[model samples]
Target: MKEDLALMERALTELHPGLYRYNTKEEFARKIADFEAKLNEPLREDRFFLLTAQLLSGIKCGHTYLNPYNQKKEIFERLIGRQTYIPFHFRFIDGFFVITENASEFDLPKGSAITSINGRTVDEIVQGLVSVSTADGDGTTLTRLRSVDLSRENGASYAHFDLYFPIFFPLDRPEFEIEAISYRSKEKVRLKVPAMTKQERTAAMEKKYGKTPGYDEGWSFKFLKDGTGYLKIDNFITWKLSIDYKRFLADSFSRLKEAGATDLIIDIRNSDGGDAGVVTELLRYLHKDPFSCETGIRTFIRTAKADPELLKYASVYDQDLKAALLNGVPKDRYKPAKNGLLEFLNGAVACPETEPYADRFDGDVYLLTGPDNASAAFTLAKRVKEASLATLVGRSTGGNLNGFNGGSYLFFNLPNSGFEFDIPVFAYHPADSSQAKDSGIEPDVNAISTASDAGEAFDRTLDKTLRLIKEKQAR
Candidate 1:
């Protein structure tokens, strides 16, 4: 256990690009010591995993995490495959665990506020979860966004809350003792709900909601009653689907122009980013002038090569890292930077302008953003705000405003525990680094959803944006 912990510490210090970006070396060393002190007694694998997650969360990098998908089958089965999940879907809205969909046999209705779970207050549960939940810098939006299961059909095998809640705060019994305020009656109620496995929860949700659309089918385009063109992009990960995104955007804009639509709303509220190229492609249709996606990209290590000692326990997608001791780093591509870091010469170039499409839409663009707008999606919001290209609506975004660590990663599996965690290698900085390091892109207009909004299936943000457009037209 000690050896594996040492290796983990060494790997982070040597490879993680943003290891010290938000914290000092001494501070990180202290965190490691604190974690080690807890090892005075034996810990179960699940407990150790929780501690490791909390340790990584201190790095403040969104992409850096112990991904459940990458873990071994046995580990996943033992930890998450059990029938330990709460029997409903919910969203944390305005400091309340507002029920969105009830999957259990209970009489609780949508819009009810879950006050407590197994005797733990909602605030206490959230505070404990936030300590372990990973986010970009100090941004709380991503944490709040992830602490829910609003869309079970979005291809995620398990929800964050479902996966971690039971592990963090184990129940004395198999079921959950839940207390909630009734949405319709305005009366406090208590319920004892039986636990469900991941599969069971999916089945219950589908049985109730009739199997809603998945992420692949989530993207859509429609003209509102007021003639505003509404484009809903569920994510930027078009590569996974058969849809030709470039053509899709081109056709959407062409149709809008033909319809003489002077108002367009691009809804990316559910987008947590995917291919950066997709973001750039979308920008071509919206941005009137030439624009670049990033100002610079850098890494801590000069090469993709891994340390010989640690390579055996690490699984890498970067081919250069796979060859480890056999291959050498190409000197021409990487140049030495300050603080013994390596700057990718190819990535350090100034903003390389991309020409706007000839058929770029000239309409007033209203971007509907939310907490899930991180990575490439966050980049889109940042660029649009910088260039005055769109009026952003909804809540603040997820990624850091100054910059974020991504573009590449180093996946490490602790040998003893067989636990896996990833370290983001590249940091992509925006043109403006003057903003707070912990801050996300704030919207031009702030709009939040209420429990009633969820229950009624209403979109407060979109409604507010449409009103603003109508008011502008009135003027």
Candidate 2:
């Protein structure tokens, strides 16, 4: 236990200084001690690792995490079979749990209330879990707490929580009971529903989403006859595909122009973040550039210090040096891009990519965003807003947008039982700062997804965009 704590502390204080800077050493040490004291029992080798996984959840940085080293990969593979995931999508609205989607087996109706999980009230579980959630967005704390891989944090046998609700039983030989309550009447009812295996639920999810054309990976596009394009980008994991992606995007724009397309809808709901290069490449398709947003060197220095490896190279321009430089640089030097992550950097400034998009699409663009819209996606949205090329339509993005660079990890085994920890170093920030860093981009048009709006074949935001496009065409 001491060894594990020591390693964790080292990872925070020495290996990953970013994790330590906000809190004083004595304060952080006390926090660690408090955390250790909270554990009810001594951890087993495997369980220790699971706890470590839970620890990463507390940091709130989207990119930092530890993976299993040693036999953990094999253990993880083996463990995958023993556990099951509760396959349901939910959101928090008005401080109440609302069901957005569920498998037929669960039969939990849309707009149904989720009163409790495993005898614990929804609020209790959320408070316990959200502090460690990587999910970004408004109710993100709650959504992530309930919607994440719970089985990993707790044990596999108990990984699946028993959800109780009032409703008709979806099947016989029930795995769990359903209890429902009327919002107005305040009456409760109960029924038993059979639970679907995690694999079955996963298969259903895949089959359901797999039907969408071009749903393969990374950035995929679909075109509508009315000059509206639906483009879904998965992540910015690599820049090697940027040229190919740009070519395909250019081709799609040519086709849209030929077909008299009037608008573009860029869907960035599920993306967390990736290389800024992807955003830079996408800029090639826009017709105009945006106003400049200066990101001072303080932000850059902190970002550089976040990663020990980055600090190795960036130490020369530490906080003091970077601050001095920012003071000396001309204010007019920086500019915000259509994607802030793609902002151009000068010799001394750390900025988003400044790559120009092909000057092909001059029409209005509609961006479908959500809390899950994060990192690079937020950067892109910021740039688009600045350029006046697109109006964001949807919820505020998950506000944890930090300038991100690729990360590296280290593996360590717990001394007593051989539990392992993974650490990430090397956090980077864009040189420009037109948009707020921690707070995400706010949508120009407030488009929200409601529990009542699910499975309606039409989306309110899509409808709104369609109407706007028609209005523009009429003009």
Candidate 3:
């Protein structure tokens, strides 16, 4: 146990101490001691590892994370263990958990009140859930939920807690009763739900995407007549797969020209994020040279000797210096940097760059966004709006455009406890904006869906986008 504590001290010492400031080092040590004491109780290594991961997740910086903590398949399998999830899809409406779509299992009716989760009221939940401006509060809550897998089996569903918030509440379970009002009668009802395995959940998801123009690699492009286009992107992890985006855009535009297309609607409603390449490519099609988007801060370490206490977590790289700083025998040696290879490798390509477009997109471009449009995708959206290349037509973005500090990924195995945590060491932000981080980019035109449209199977937002295209074409 002493050895583990020493190991933790060594590992954590590599981090910039500005992360958790106290008046003295002894204070930090005491906190660590308290945390260690708690672990001596009910938590196992694996469980502690998850809790540690969740603790790290609280940082909320896009680049900060511990990956391969478990295999990808294993992670998915764990998610499948929960057959039930919060049924209603919510978005922060004037700070309320406004229900957009309520699934039957949630038993909570659409357009109903979401007074509390576990015991934390909606206000309490939203308090810790920052408004980084992506898709409002709904997007904020959902994104946080995804950061750490919270399965019903893990007691997470009923014991609702924010990734960042320390408070814990026991949410009602399958047979548990809760006061909830239905959208139909506006009356309260008690609901019961059943749990299913991961396989069942996957099957259900597969069925959901089976007919929609979805892609296994995670993107979809559908060109419709009347000069309208629909594109659904799942994540912005990389731009290599989207190399054809420019070609597609050009060809689609040409087709639209033939079909007399006057407006383009790009849907990023489900996109989590990718590299900055997509934005670069899209911007190339829209702007001329001398066009460059902001790339946040460039961090660097003052010295290796500054270990544990002084290193303020810079986002820069020094190959030889970094290596030497981390060099040592079994204890002091630094392993490879997690998620820092992109910065470490510098010019080396992590993912293929998207092809630049020679022609700029003209006419009105209506972008449909949600909470899922994050990270690099959010950066792209911010630049688009900054350049006035496109008028954002949907929900707020999920990523912050102003302050962000998550580039270096920190991996830690609790020596005393065997638990682990992944931490992002770098943060960044664009220069020419007053927009704050945690608060996302607001849309120029807001279009949201309601339960009435769902009942009719009508996409009012999509319909509005199409109508706008026609209006542009008519002109």
TM-score of 2: 0.69
* lDDT of candidate 3 over 366-458, digit per residue (tens): 777765567667777787787787768776777664444444444544435434444444434333334444467778777776544433456
Error of 1 at 324 (Å): 8.0
Please give the ranking of all candidate structures by TM-score, highest first, separated by commas: 1, 2, 3
| Candidate 2, 1-475: lDDT as tens digits | 7666765666555544245322345766776776687555765544454455456555545544443223345554444432233445555544445555555464566566566543556666555445445543233442253333222112112231311121111223335454544333445645444455645655665565442222235577788666478777765556535447657677777776776666788877666566666666666676455423334422211222233432332222135543433343343543333332212234345445444444467777888776655557767776777677688887777634444322344444555544454444433444344552545667888866554554343477777777778887898
lDDT of 2: 0.51
Error of 3 at 232 (Å): 3.0
User: lDDT of each structure?
Assistant: 0.80, 0.51, 0.48
Candidate 3 structure, TM-score to reference: 0.64
Clashing pairs in 1: none
Which has the greatest TM-score?
A: 1
Q: Write the per-residue lDDT of candidate 1 for residues 1-475, one digit (tens) a residue.
A: 7777888898888778778778899999999999899888998988888889889989888888888768999988988778787877788776678887888888888889898999988888887777676678865555445645445643236567876788888877779999999988989999999998878888888887887666566578889999999999987877777777777788888889889999999999888888888778878888878877555334345345557776667777776656732365577767776645676665765666899998888989999998888888988898788789899999899888657788766789998999999977676654344544567889999997787887787899999999999999999
